[model samples]
Target: MISKDTVKEIKILALHIRMETMKAIGNLGFGHIGGALSITDTIAALYGGAMKYDPKNPQWEQRDWLVCSKGHAGPAIYSALALKGFFPVEELLTLNKPGTNLPSHCDRNLTKGIDMTTGSLGQGASLAVGVALGHKLDGRDNFTYLILGDGEIQEGQVWEAVLFAAQKKLDHLITFVDYNKKQLDGYTKDINDVGDIKSKFEAFGWHGQEIDGSNVIEIIEAIENAKQHKDKPSVIVLHTIKGKGWAFAEQELFNHHMNISRDQMEEALTVLSAELEGLVKE
Candidate 1:
């Protein structure tokens, strides 16, 4: 179980992720806002305490690995890494700019803490499976965590990787599906829905569960449960809001990729700043 102090810490980290992500995207006045913000809590849950790593030695052997298969959410991962001391928080503003390490999509070669370079949808699943199997082969207990988008799973490559992961009994591989219900052009339900992802993963011979994606305690508890079960890989279906923590984006129908004007960004920040202040004071 997650301790009270740990929960508070996660909450703080989640706020930082949200703020930095907004600031980074707000710098360019546009980005994949909806998806980037959606995974904030999950990213916080991992970096807050769940994952092991040394910012100074990002490639530490004993460290846990994360694959953000939904690579467009690079801003959120970048924010978490920066907050964790992987790099200067100021560099976050360089996102997607020429010669900058933080690209629009995650690139291991460019970023300090990124494990596998991921941009193409569903490809991260394959890379994550390989990372887990490699660890198992080398007799390492490190866990490989993967985050997939609900829309990304529509690709056949994701299913192939899922089948392979279960076949290998990769118990160390934990996958989180960001089921925010919105895709780029339309709602997931209206645009080729993969109904019941948890059951689908279970049918493929993996332990799967669905949970409230934005809840820090539930997210941590679910991760603990996934770690406890040893046999096949585990998949957690995160029922999340597409644009969580941001008022304007939350109500947008086509929020997958949208423009973030300065006023809109600051509006979101005002709300976040107040909550962050309250949390810190508590």
Candidate 2:
């Protein structure tokens, strides 16, 4: 079990990721907010505690790697990276602007901390598996983590990578499925219901677990459990709420991507600031 103080710190970090992500997206007036918000807590869990990385030396040979297969959630990762000192926090305001390092999708070439350039769905899954395998071949103990969207599993190539990871027994590879239920157009049930994500991964020879993605404690515990199993890769199905931290966006039908006016941004910022203050007071 994680200590109370560590849990509190993780919660604070998650809130910071959410606040910074909102600021970054709000700067552009619009972005893929729903998916980005859903994955903030998980990113916080990894960057804030579980993962081994160096902000000043992002390419350090001994550090672990992260590949966000759901690349549209790049804003959340950027927020965490900046907060961790991979770049200046002020740089987050330049997301997607001309010549900015942060883009709509994660690009290792452009960003300091991003491990792999991943925009096309299913491709990052493959890249993550290869990286994990490469690390194993080199006798390195570092782990490679990947985050995938619920809708992204519709791609056949993702399964191919899944099969390969199992065959190679990449025990150091960990994956998370942000099962937020909604995709860009509509709910996953209406579009393509990837039935029982955890069960499907288990069938594909992965050690699978499902947990509340928004809860930092559950996210941390799941990673701890995944570390105990050594025969196969692990996948944590993160049941999350799309647009989790924003009330208006959570209720909007088309929250996947939309324009946010200055007033809306101000309202969100005010609410988030209050929440952060509450956490700090605690």
Candidate 3:
């Protein structure tokens, strides 16, 4: 279990990743701002407080695996990876550039720390489950973390993955669903109501928990609790605001899947700076 100090570290790492995300995409001039921002806290909990990884050996056999089910949010993952020293922080500026390895979607083969190439939504969740099963079969003490968007759940495959994980009793897998209520088009309710993802997972024989995705402490505890329930895979439904820290961006649906404008970039940095200060106090 993580102590107060570890929880503090998670918050600090979250703030740093959130800031790095804004700066990285700010350099790219645009990217999936809303979704990336929404999952920053979970990313922090995983990278800083949960996952075991090495900067020098990203492909280490015992390293915990992370699959970005909402692959467009690769910016957040990249930021965390860079901060964890998987790569030089300067490379973040080259994100989405024609020649850069970092594309709009995460490609595991291309990026050092990414475990799966995931852009097609629901498939990544299934892939993460597969990795967990592989670990279990090999008798390796590794965990698999999969981060999915609420919109991504619209895909039929995601439910299939959820059912499969539960049926197989893949306890090593912990899935986080970004239940921000917004998707690419608009609110998730407007797009295609994903009716009670928690209940759905529970019905499918999985252990489901609801959490405030933006809360670092809640994220850490929920995941840790899920880890202990070995009868089934755990699914955490995280209630979050799409553009978590940016007020203007949060209100605009179009901002859910947009690049940063020059003015927006400045505003993002300002908000991030304030958030960083707040995190330091924790």
Candidate 4:
């Protein structure tokens, strides 16, 4: 178990992830705000407190892997990677820029710390399972972590991957479902409802748990518990709020995807700056 000091460290890192992400979106003026905000705590727990990675050599053979299945949240992942020293944070402004390596979707070959090129929705989760399996087969001790959007669970491929992970007993793999309950079109209930993902993964042979995705301490605990299982993949279905932090966006319907208007950008900046005032780095 992690000590209280370590838990504090995790919270600090999560706040920084949100800070940098808000700044990046503020720069872009508009992007995948909801998904980006929802995944901040998960990114923090992995990059800051859990995963083993080197800022200078992201492809180090012994490094633990991270796959952002909900790739639209690449902005948030980029924020954490930069803060973790994977690359210079200033390069974030070039996000989605023409000819820039940082596209809206993550590309492992292009981004120093990114382990997979993902934006195809349900694929990254499955890919993480594959990575874990490969490591296990090779007799390596590394772990694979992945995050998925609740809406993406509607895809058929995700279930196939779930079954595969369970049957293969890929215990080295862990996945988190960002249960923000809203997608691009509208609330998930109005769209194709994804019945309880926790129950689904559990039924398919996973050790499943649910937690508040925004809480760093709970997420860290979930990861710790997940690592203890020896014969089943573990999953934490994270309940979250779409467009969290920025109240205006948080209250908006379909904050799933949004464009930042000039006025809205100013408002978001004001709110984020206010939120950042007391955050300290560990």
lDDT string, candidate 4, 1-282, tens digits: 678777777667666777677667777777888899888878888887689999988889999998888889999899888998888989887888788777888998888889999999889977888899999999998999988899998988899999999999999899999999899999898889887889999999999999998888889889999999899999999999888777888899978777777677667667666655655432
lDDT: worst 10-residue window of model 3: 253-262
Off by over 4 Å in 3: none
Best by lDDT: 1
The lowest-lDDT stretch of 10 consecutive residues in candidate 4 is 273-282
Q: C-alpha displacement of 99 in model 4, angstroms?
A: 1.3
> Clashing residue pairs in candidate 2, if any?
none
Cα lDDT tens digits, model 2, 119-187, are 899999999999999999999999999999999999999999999999999999999999999888888
Q: Each model's TM-score, in the order given? A: 0.99, 0.99, 0.96, 0.95
Which ten residues in a row are the worst by lDDT in model 1? 1-10
The RMSD of every model to the true structure, in order and in angstroms, is: 0.7, 0.8, 1.4, 1.8
- C-alpha RMSD of candidate 4: 1.8
lDDT of 3 by residue, 137-183 (tens): 99997999999999899999998998889888999998999988888
TM-score (C-alpha) between model 2 and the true structure: 0.99
lDDT (10s digit) by residue, model 1, range 104-206:
9999999999998988999999999999999999999999999999999999999999999999999999999999999997899998988999999999999
In candidate 2, stretches whose alpha carbon ends up further than 4 angstroms from where it belongs are none
Regions more than 4 Å wrong, model 1: none
Candidate 3 lDDT: 0.88
Each model's number of backbone clashes?
A: 0, 0, 2, 0
